[model samples]
Target: MTSPGVAPGLLRVQGLCSGYGRSQVLFGVDLHIGEGEILGVLGRNGMGKTTLVRSIMGLLRPTGGTVELGGRAIVGLAPHRVARQGIAVVPEGRQVFANLSVLEHLTAFARGGHGTAHAWTIDRLLHLFPRLAERRSNLGGQLSGGEQQMLAIARALATNPRLLILDEATEGLAPLVREEVWHALSTLRQAGMSMLVIDKYVRRLIGLADRHVILEKGEVAWTGSSAQLEADRSLWSRHLGL
Candidate 1:
């Protein structure tokens, strides 16, 4: 089902319930991201932010609810199947292959003929994150945390996904590096790339995302435009513990 009063979006989650080993996390959560829209998911720790991303990525089987991409259900599909369906996730912790070089990472996951003329080629991704270009021959394990994060995002983009989900993309990094990452994201936004961004940097998220979804205890406590969220500080304190 579509979100009330909103058109069907590129990705939609309705009454989504999920958990690990019977410990339920998400509870009837609902949110959507329109084409070329950026949706920010915000919450305090243990509030099921990652759980929601995992459920969408098909990493964890949801106990109930529906997950749809481009209006098609993908509830029980495998993780790879979900990726093939045009959803790519830059998981928390920037899980780059330790043994792979920067060039290898992009080439291995590149999805040819699936993207527009602006498709993320290795050179394009390197252009987006120039440090990665300089470190093309460097192994993933040798890069700094910020560089690793950049690579993780680049690898996901290589798939040319219709929707990109970034779980805590700027969790731990220097201020400069975080700014770099945010700049790349803003550039992607300008290019009309749809994204679901999960980051603790609410201020930055407000500047980047078109809309926001605040998750509290596995449920969507509030959702609104960036302007609305920016004007409501109580929502920030109550739901986000900011």
Candidate 2:
């Protein structure tokens, strides 16, 4: 299911349908992210944004459709299997271990991934996230929300994942902290780390992401470049309530 200009592999979702019990959330959602591309996922609350992430991460089983990561179907696979397949997710919540030190949290990923020479190492991650380095010994629960969010990102990078999925990366951070998080994401993009970013800041996403996909009622209603999205504010006000 290669899209025009999209290589064979990479992250591709085609007609993905998912739900919790009888409550169907995602309906025929289709989207893709390519190597070294930063793709934005945008939508208002209750629009199946997280559901799509869950389905991709194997946190939820898709009743219908396919999820192909790196040219292989990952639908119905366990979360660990999905992670092993080069997909690391920083979920909506930081979800860090309350008692684990920052160092321990990252070091736990013994089976590091991302085979490239510039793979993410703990030293590199600490350099990318200086705050985490400063709090290397601090327990996850001892950090502020922003710090925890940084830890969450650094922890995921530790796995050396080829694809990084960040759900609400800066959801509850202070303005300054939000800016920091955004800067880190931008840096990752520049470093050629493929990303699927879901943030409330639509304008920021449009500026940073190479492509944008807007979901409506569990389906992709609009997919285009930043320039295309910027030219049409109606799309924002309609699907995203921007």
lDDT of 1 by residue, 1-242 (tens): 33344455689899999999979999999988887788999999999999999999889999999999989999999999999999999999999999999999999999963456678888999999999999999999999999999999999999999999999999889999999999999999988888999999999999999899988889988989899999999998898778
* Shift of residue 194 alpha carbon in model 2, Å: 0.4
Local lDDT at 127 for model 2: 91
CA RMSD of all predictions: 2.1, 1.6
For candidate 1, the TM-score is: 0.95
lDDT of candidate 2 over 1-242, digit per residue (tens): 23356454589898999999999999999888888788899999999999999999988999999999878999989999999999999988899999999999989973556676687888888999889999999999999999999999998898888899999998979999999898989889888898999988988898898888988888888999888889999998898777
Q: What ranges in model 2 sit over 4 Å off?
A: 1-8
TM-score of each: 0.95, 0.96
Candidate 2, pairs of clashing residues: none
Model 1 accuracy (lDDT, Cα): 0.91
